[model samples]
Target chain A: MAELTYREALNRALDEEMARDPKVFLMGEEVGEYDGAYKVSKGLLGKYGARRVRDTPISELGFTGLGVGAALAGLRPVVEWMTHNFALLALDQVVNNAAKMRQMSGGQLKVPIVFRGPNGPAEFLAAQHSQALASYWAHVPGLKVVAPATPADAYGLLKSAIRDDNPVVVLESEMMYAWKGEVPEEEFLVPLGKARLAREGRDLSLVTFSKPIKAVMEAAELLRAKGIEADVVDLRSIRPLDEESLYASVRKTGRCVVVDESWPVASVGSHVAWLVSHNCFDLLDAPVELVSGEDVPMPYNHSLELAAQPSADKILGAARRVLYREDI
Target chain B: MAKTAKNGRNTLPPREILFPLLETMQLIRAFEEKSGQMYGLRKIGGFCHLYTGQEAVATGAISVLDLSRDYVLTAYRDHGHALACGMEPAPLMAELFGKLTGSSRGKGGSMHFFSAEKHLLGGNGIVGAQIPIATGVALAQAYEDSGGATLCFFGDGAFHQGALHESFNLAKIWNLPIVYIVENNQWGMGTSWKKVSAQSDFVATAAAYSMKGLVCDGMDVLNVRDVVGEAVEEARKGNPVFVEARTYRYKGHSMSDPQKYRSRDEVDEYRRRDPIVFLRSRMEEAGLIGEEDWEAIVQRTEGLVEEAVRFAETSPEPSLGELYADILA
Candidate 1:
C-alpha cells in the first residue's frame, strides 16, 4: 500500500485508465496546460500529450456535450468541470443528453463517461461556489453519483466510474483533496453502490460521505470520549445507495444522524434519514437527526461562512442529541 | 461567390447521381407528408415536426457522406435525414407509434432516431444540443486519425445558440473533421429567425472560428449536393466547415402549431422553388428522366410508407417489464 492524497489518488486513476484504453481522453479547462484547475490532472498532459489530454476553452456546456457525443461515437472521455459550481452551465447537456442518450436511443448508445470535479464549500467561496449540488444530480435517474471520503475510495471509485457504461458524476471536495490515506498498490476497485464502514460503534450511527465524513468521524470520537459509542458509515455511492448497509447499521444502533455538506432540505443525507425512519421505524430508539448546512447561502465572512456550513461541532451536537445527551 | 469553396474543394455532380438524389428527396417528402397525414388523423402522438419543404437539404447533404463510415447528427426534424440515411421506415414509424418494434424500441419518438450501422447518431430534441456532440464525434475521428467525418445539421435558429459558437471554436483549434450544415428554414417555431437572431447571416458566423463558410440554395437539391460535397471533401482532410442551406419548412413546426407566424404568400414563394420540383425540371431539361421512372419512384415510396404503417399498427406496445430495462448497460 502507498500513502497518497485524494488528488493524487484521482490522478493515478486517470493515468491508469488512460494507459489501459487508447480511446480514453481527458478534456476540460486548464486540465492540460494548467494540470487541472485543482492540479488533480497533474503530469497527465505531459504523459498523454495534447491529443489525449486536451485543454478546452471556458465553454463548459460545449465541452461537456462534446464529451457525451464522443462517448456515443465509442470514445471514453473523462471531463473535468473545474468545479461543480461551474457545472450548472452544462446541466442541460448532463441531464438531457448524457443521462438520457442510452435509454432514449433504445440501448444503441452507452455514454461511458465520467464528469469529475471538486464540489461542496471550501473556505469562504460564498453563494454560488459554495453549494453542494449532489442532490439535484442524484435525483435524476440514469446517472450514478459517488462521493469518496478517503484516498482509497477516490482511487477505486474514480477508476470504476471511468469504466462504467452509464454517465457517472464524482463529486470531490477542495478541502478533502489534501487529506492523505493509504491506497493499495495492486489493482483494486471500490464498487459503486457500496458503503464503507469508517468506524464501528453500537449506541448510534453516523451516516455521511465526502468531506462531511471527516466531521462525522471527529464527532464520533467526541462521542466516544464521552462514552457514547457511535458507528460511522461512509455512503460511497449516492444513487444506487447502499440501502442494506444503512438499514443494518440503523437497525443495530437504534439511533442515527445523517451529516451532509448540503443544506438540510431535501439534501442527500436527508434522504438517508428518511430511509432510516421509514424502514427502521420499529428499530429506532430516537428520532433520526440530520446535521446539514444552514439554509442560507454561504456568507463571505469567515466565521459566518463556517457557521453557515456543517461542522464537526455540529455533527457532535446532533450525535449527542440523538443519544439523549447534552445537545450543546 | 466562391461556389468552389475557399479551399477550392467543391465537386460538380456527375449526371448519373441526379436520379438517385431525386429519389432520395422524393422519399423524404413522401415520408414526411404521410407522417403529417397520420398526425392529423390522431394516429401518431407527441410532437411531429415535418421536413416538408427542406427535402433538398437532407437529400443533397447526405449524398456527400460515405454512409458506411461517416456520421450524421441532426435536430428533431429528423425523419427526412433518417430516410436519406437509409434507415427502414418501419422501425421509424413504429417509434412514432411508441411500439416495441420502434427504432428506439418506442422510447424515442419523432425526436430521437439513431442507426448505429448507418452511423446516424440521433435526432436530438434540445435546440443546438447536437452541435457540441457532433463536434466531439469529429474529435474522436481526428484522435483516431480516421478518415471519417461528421455532418452536424441544425436549424437557423439553433445557429444563435452559444454551443454552436463553442463547437466552431473547438473544431477550428482541434482541426476536427466535421461539416456543420445549418438548415436556415427561417422560422423557429412561432418566431421568425430574423426576430430571434440579431445577425441572420449564419454562414458569416464561421469566420469567427476561421472555418470555410459557404451558402447554398437549399431549395435546389443539386445546389445543396454540390456545395455540401465540397465541404465534406475539405472536412475529410481534417478541416471543418460551416454551411448555410437556405431552406424552408412548408408544414408548421409541429402538429400543435397554428403557424400564425408567416403568410401563405411566403410559403407559396418557397414552394415554387421546391427542391423536388426543381430537380425534376432540371432532369427533364437534361432529358435524363422519364414518366415511367417517376411513377415507379412514387409507387415504391407510397408502398413503403403503407407497409410501415401496417408494421407499426401490428407491433406490440412495450411490455410492462421493458420500462425497467435499458436503464443501465
Candidate 2:
C-alpha cells in the first residue's frame, strides 16, 4: 500500500482506465492544456495526447451532451465538470439525455459514461460556488451517485464508475482533494452501493460521507473522551444507499445521527435519518437526529462560512441530543 | 433547383432513382396520415407530432446516408425519419401504441424512436437536445477515424436554443463530421419563427462560426437529396456544415393543436407545391413512371401502413415487471 492524495488517486484511476480501454477518453474545460481546473488530470494530456484528453470550449451543455452522444455511439467518455457548481448549466443534458437514454431507447443504447468533479463548499467562494448538490443527482432515478471520503475510496469508486454501464455521477469534495490516505499498491475496486465501517462502537451511530466524514470522526473522538462510544458509518455511495449497514448500525446502537454538508430539506442526510427512524422505530432509544449545513446560501465571510458548514462541534451537539446526554 | 442524375452522385438510371425516392416519401406520407387518423380515434396517445407535409426533409437528407454506418438523430417529430432510416413501421406503430413489441418496448412513445442497428440514435423529446449528442457522435466518428458522418435534424422552433449554437461551435472548431440540418417548417407550435427569432435567415447563422452553409427547397425531395448529399460529402472530409431545408408542416404541431397561428389559405399555398405531387409531375415529364406505376406505389405504401397498424394492435402491453427493468445496465 502507498499513501496518495485524493486528487492523485483520482488521476491514477483515470490514467489506469484510459490505458485499459482505448475507447475511454477525457473531455472538459481546461482538462488538457490547463491540466484540469483542479489539477486532477495533471500530465494526462501529455500521456494520452490531444485526441483522448480533449480541452473543450466553455460550453458545458454542448460538451456534456456530446459525451452522452459519444456514449450512445459506443465510446466511453469521462466528462469532468470544472466544478459541480458549473454543472447546473449542463443539467438538461445530464438529467434528460444521459439519465434517460438507456431506458428511453428500450435498453438498446447503453451510455457507459462518468461525470466527475469537485462538489460542495471550499474556502469563501460564496453561495453559487459553495453548494453541495449531490441530492439533485441522487433524487433522479437511473443515476448512480458516489461520494468518497478517503483516497482509496476515491480511486476505487471512480474506476468502478467508469466501468459501469449506466451514467454515474462522482461527487468529489474540493476541501478533501489534498487529504492523503493509504491506497492499495495493486489494482482494486470499491464497488458501488456499499458503506465502510469507519469506526465501531455500541453506544450510538454517526452516519455520514464525503468531507463531513472528517467532522463526524472527530465528533466520535470527542464523544469517546466523554465515555460515549459511537459507530462511524461512512456512506460511500448515496443513491443505491447501503440500507443494510445503516439498519444494522441503528438497530445495534438504538440511536442515529446523520451529518451532511448540504441543506436539510429533502437531503441525503434527512433521507437517511427518515429511513432509520421508520425502519428502526421500535428499537430506537430516541428520535433520529440530523446535523446539516445551515438552511441558507453560504456566506462569504470566513467565520460565517465555517459556521454554515457541519463542524465537529455541531456534530457532537447532535450526538449528545440523540444520546440523551445534552446536559452532560 | 435539384441537379440532374447525370450531374449528381446518383448514377442510377432515372427510373430506379426517382421511383425509390417517391416510394420512400409515399411510405412516410401514408404512415403519418394513418397515425394522425389513429391519434384522432385515440388509439395512439401522448403528443403525436405528424410529419405530414415535411416528408421530403427527412426522406431526402437521410437518403444520402450509408444506413449501415452513418448515424441519424432528430427531435420528436421522428416517424418520418425512422421510416427513412429503414426501421420497419410495425415497431414504430407499436411504440406509438405503447405496446411491448414497440421499438422502445413502449417506454418511448411518439417522441422517441430508436434503432441502433439502423444507426438511428433517437428522437429526442426536448427542443434542440439532440444537437449536442449528434455532435458527440460525430466526434466519436472522427476520433476513431471511422469515415462516418452524423446527420442531426431539428425544427426551426429549436433554432434559438443555446445547445444548438454550442454544438455548431464545437463541430466547427473540432472539425467534427456532422451536418446540422434545421427543418425550417416556420412555426414553433403556435408562434411563428418571425416572432421568435430576430434573424429569419438560418443559413446565415453558419457563417457566424465560419462554417459552410447550404439551403435547399425542402418541398422538393430530389433537391433535398442533392443539397444534403453535397453537405454529407463535405462533412466526411472534416468540414461540418449547417443546412436549412425550407419547408412547411401541413398538420398542426401535435395531436391537440388548434393551429390558430396561420390561415387555411397559407396551408393551401404550400399544399400546391406538395413534395409527392412535385416528384410525380417531374417523373411524368421524364416518362420514368406512368400513371399506373404511381397507383401501384400508392397501393404498396397503404398496404405497408395497414400491416403496421395490425402489428401494433395485436402486440401486448409491456409486463408490470418491465417498469423496474432497464433503469440501469
Candidate 3:
C-alpha cells in the first residue's frame, strides 16, 4: 500500500484501465497535452500517446455524443467535463443518449462510458460553475452516479465505473482532490451501490458523501467528545443506493442524520431521509434529520458562500437535534 | 467525353446498376404511397414523414456503398433509407404499425427505426442530433481500423444546428471516415431554406470545416451515385466529405401537415422533375427494358406493397411486458 492523493488515485485508475483495455481512452478539453485542467489525467498522454489520450475541442455536446457513439461501437470512453457545470451543454447526450440508449434500443446497446469531473459548490466560483448535479442525474433511472470521498475509494470506484456495463457519472469534488490516504498499488474495484462505514458508533448515524462526508465526519468526532457515539456512512454510489446498508445502520443506531451539499429542496438529502423513514420507521427513536445547503443560488461572497453550504457545525447541530428529540 | 473510374475499370454496365436503382426507387415509391393510405385510415399514428420525392438520394447512396461493411444513420425521413438498405418492406411496415415484427420491435414507431443487422443505426427524431452520433460511428471505424465508412444523412435544416458544425470540425480534425450528405429538400417542415439560412450555400459551410464539399442534383440518381460515390471513396481513404443534395419533397413534411406554407404549384413543379420518372425515361431511351418488362416490375412492386400491408395488419402488437424488453442489455 502507498499514500495517494485523490487526484493521483484517479490518474492511477485511468492509467491502469487504459493499460488493461486499449478501447478505454480519455477525452476532454485539456485532458491530453495540457495534462488535465485538474491534473487528474497528468502524464497520460506521454504514456498512451495522442490517440488514446485525446484533447477534444471546446464542444461538450459534440464530444459527449461522440463518446456515446464510440461506446455503442464497443469502446469504453472516459469523457471528462472540466466541471459538472459544463455538463449542461452535453445534457441532451448524457440524459437522452447515454442514459436511455440501452432502454431505447431494447437492450441491444450498452453505453460503457464515464462522464467524470469535479462537481458541487466551490468558493467564489459563482452560480454558473458551481452545482451539485448528483440529484439531477440520479433522477434518471439508467445512469449510475458515484461520488468518492477518499483516495482509495476514488481509485477503486473509478475502476468499477470503467468496468460497468452501463453509463456511470463520477462526480468528483474540486475541494477534495488534494486529500490523501492509503491506497493499494495493485488492481482493486469497489462495487457500485455499496455503502462504506467510515466510523462505527451506537448513538446516531451521520450519512453523507462527496465533499459533505468530510464535514459529517468532523461533526461525528465532535459528537464523540460530548459522549455521543455517532456512526458515519459514506454513500459512494447514489443511483443503485445501498438501502440495505443504510437500513442496517439506522436499525442499529435507531436515529440518523443526512448531510448533503446540494440544496434543501428535492435533494439527495431528502431522498436519503425518505428512505430511512420508509424502511426503518419502527426502529428509529427520532425522526430523520436533514442538513443540506440553503435554497438560494450559491453567492460569490466568501462568507456567504460558506454559509450557503452545509458546514460541520450545522451537521453537529442536526445530529444533536436528532439524538435528543423530546418526542421520542 | 470519357469518364474516369477510380479503379480504372469501365463504368458499371448500364443494366447492371440502373435496374437495381429503378427497382429500389419503385419499391420505395409503392411502399410510401401505401403507407400514406394506411396513415390516412388511422391504422398508423404518430409522425409519418414520407420520402416520395427523395427516393433517388437513398437509392443512389445505398447503391454506391458496401452494405456489409458500411453503416448508415439518418434523420426522421428514414423509411426509404431503411428500405433501400435491404430491410424487408413487411417488417418496416409492421414497425410503423407498432407491431412486434417490426425492426425496432415496435418500440420506435416512425422516427426511431433501428436494425443492427443491416447496420442502419437509427432514424433519430431530434433535429441535427444524429450528426455527431454518425461522426462518432466513423471515429470508431477509424479507431478499430475496421476499414468501414459511415454515411450520415441529414436535411439542409440540420446544417443550421450547432451540432452539425461541431461534428464537422471533429470529423475533419480526426480525418474520420464519414460522408455527410445534406438532403436539401428546400423546406424543413414548413420553413423554406431562404427564410432560415442567412448564407444559403451549404457547400460553403462545409468548406468552413476544411472538409471536401459538393453540390449535386439529387433528382438524378446517376448524378447522385457518381458524386456520392466519389465522396464515399474519399471517406474510405480516411478523409471525411460533405455533400449537399439539392432535391425536393413532393408530399407534405409529415402526414398531418396541410401544405399551407408552399402552394400546390410548387409541389407540382417538383413532381415534374421526379427522380423515378427521369430514371424511367433514361432506361426507356436506352432500350434497357421493354414496355412489358416495365409493367411487370410495377406489378411486382404492387404485389410486394400489398403483401407488406397484409403482414402489418395481421402482425400482433407487442405485449405489455415487452415495454421493458429493450431498455437494457
Model 3 chain B: lowest-lDDT 10 consecutive positions: B1-10
Q: Can you write out model 1's per-residue Cα lDDT over B21-122, one digit (the tens) per residue?
A: 888888888888889888888878989999999999989899889986699999999999999999999999999989999999999999999888888988
- The candidates' DockQ values read 0.83, 0.90, 0.60
Error of 1 at A78 (Å): 0.8
Candidate 3's iRMSD? 1.5
Q: Which residue segments of model 2 deviate by more than 4 Å?
A: B1-13
Output the number of the TM-score-best candidate: 2
Per-prediction TM-score: 0.97, 0.98, 0.95
Whose DockQ is greatest here?
A: 2
Clashing pairs in 3: A102-B327, A103-B327, A106-B326, A107-B326
Identify the leading candidate in terms of lDDT. Answer: 2
- Best of the two (1, 2) by lDDT: 2
i-RMSD values for every candidate model: 0.8, 0.6, 1.5
lDDT tens readout by residue for model 2, A1-328: 9999999999999999999999999999999999998999999999999999999999999999999999989899999998999999999999999999989999998899999999999997999999999899999888999999999999999999999988999999888999999999999999999999999999999999899998998888888888989999999999899999999998889999999999999999999999998999999999999999999999999999999999999988888788888654
True contacts kept of each: 0.78, 0.86, 0.48
Candidates sorted on TM-score, descending: 2, 1, 3
Shift of residue A177 alpha carbon in model 3, Å: 1.1
DockQ of model 2, rounded to 2 decimals = 0.90
lDDT tens digits by residue: candidate 1, A1-328: 9999999999999999999999889999999988888899999999989999999999999999999989988999999998999999999999988989888889888889999999999996879888899998998889999999899999999999999988999999999999999999998988999999999889999999889887788778877888878888999999889999999899889999998989888889888899999999999999999988999988889999989877888887777678787743
Q: What TM-score does prediction 1 earn?
A: 0.97
